[model samples]
Target: MKVTRLSSKGQIIIPKALRAAHNWEAGQEFTAVDVGDGILLKPKKPFPEKTLAQVAGCLKYRGQPKSLDEIEDAIRQGVMEQWHDRVDTRE
Candidate 1:
């Protein structure tokens, strides 16, 4: 077993060997859960896992398909309406 020391900053440095074994890199996110004896470090997922079949056909569209430009315009309009103070420096 590997040993590690917790720094004064309350941060424990995970050993490089274990990190390499798990393919963990810098900036990896983890959720620390306190078990009875110790804390369990679990990798935090950005989003819930879902298969194509599970998410497909979730939104029904009876009308005709929208053009890419039209969809972009709609998104832009929604953003403008929501964030009135937002600046567009690109323009």
Candidate 2:
């Protein structure tokens, strides 16, 4: 078992051997959880950053895309339907 000491500045230096064994790099983040008996240090998993191109073809749509005017008109029609429904219910 390896031993480590916490500095006065609240910083703990993980032993070189343990760091090498775990393949942990400097500046790596960890989440500390209080386990009642002791603390648990878990390596933070990072989420991959994706661009629009990476997620572009995720949706399968064989139909041609609608024009901007058609899209706006559809939205307006939907909103008017919702507003009419609310007004009708109130009356």
Candidate 3:
């Protein structure tokens, strides 16, 4: 196991070998969790924040899109079918 000394500024230098192995660079962020005996350091996500535009076309639809009235009618039909099924099952 590698040993490291915590500086007076409360900063600990991760060993060069370990840092190279983990590919951790300068300004890398970490989240520290307190365990019973020691602390666990987890690397923070490196990805930038995503916007709606980035995910806008995630789902692809080749066919024509349904209108609002068509969508509502489908929902009503489904509900009526479910209600009729339940009533028939009861009788």
Candidate 4:
């Protein structure tokens, strides 16, 4: 078991062994949660959520890639189609 002494300022110095084990560096941010008898320290930053582009790796289509203009046009067309569909459904 590891031991740490609390200073006068209510700060506890994490031991070198524990720091090294957790790859914790000086000035690293952590979230301390009080778990009844003890505190749990966790990193502030978790892994980012996955996105469709990331899952696909690279786009499947081949040939001359669609330019920004083409992509924007496709998005506008899709939105207009959805809007018209909604309008038509309303009678």
Candidate 5:
């Protein structure tokens, strides 16, 4: 296991090996949480926040619209394929 210590400036220097292993770079943002006796650090999401109004219909379909039956068949086939894939992986 690796060890780290908090600095005098209320900052912690994460070890170089662990940093390289996680691909964490300088200025990486993290959210620290108190988990009972120890702290948990999670990387901050790297997405620019957007609302439904801002992103809705951005990927407009340009093809001819399919019937409701076609959509249902596609969904059913996708579910069956996924189920078979999962069952195969369990073996």
Candidate 6:
């Protein structure tokens, strides 16, 4: 177990060894959880936000894929059926 002292400002300087072991950075955000009498400190996960362009080349859209228009039409057809609208299949 590691030992640490609380400063006058109520801040505890995490030990260098523990920080190095965890690869923690100066500005990295962490969460402290109270486990009964003791506490657990862990780094907060970074958000999984990503742009479509970033994931564009990484995805494999396989099988009989439908176009955007086809998907929209399918959705509209489903909605129409739900509303009991007689679908004019002539189009």
lDDT of each: 0.90, 0.92, 0.93, 0.87, 0.92, 0.85
Q: Name model 3 segments beyond 4 Å from true.
A: 47-57, 61-91
Which structure is stronger by TM-score: 2 or 3? 3
Among residues 3 or more apart in sequence or in different chains, the pairs in candidate 1 whose N, CA or C atoms overlap within 3 Å are none
Best by TM-score: 5
lDDT of 5 by residue, 1-91 (tens): 8777888999888889988999999999999999999899988889977999999889989999889999999999999999999999999
lDDT leaderboard ranking:
3, 5, 2, 1, 4, 6
| Superposed model 5: Cα runs more than 4 Å off | 34-38, 64-80
Instruction: Judging by lDDT against the true structure, name the best candidate.
Output: 3
Give all TM-scores, in the order shown. Answer: 0.53, 0.51, 0.52, 0.47, 0.61, 0.51
Winner on lDDT (5 vs 6): 5
RMSD of each: 13.1, 13.8, 11.9, 13.6, 3.3, 14.6
Model 2 spans with C-alpha error above 4 angstroms: 48-91
Give lDDT: candidate 1, residue 76: 99
Per-residue accuracy of model 4 over 1-91 as CA lDDT, tens digit each = 8878988999998889988988989888888999999999887776666788787847478688889999999999999999999999999
Question: Worst 10-residue stretch by lDDT in candidate 6?
Answer: 82-91
CA error at residue 65 for candidate 2, angstroms: 26
Q: For model 6, name the residue pairs that clash.
A: none
Clash-forming residue pairs, model 3: none
lDDT (tens digit, per residue) of candidate 3 on 10-90: 999999998899999999999899998999998988786689999888989899998999999999999999999999999
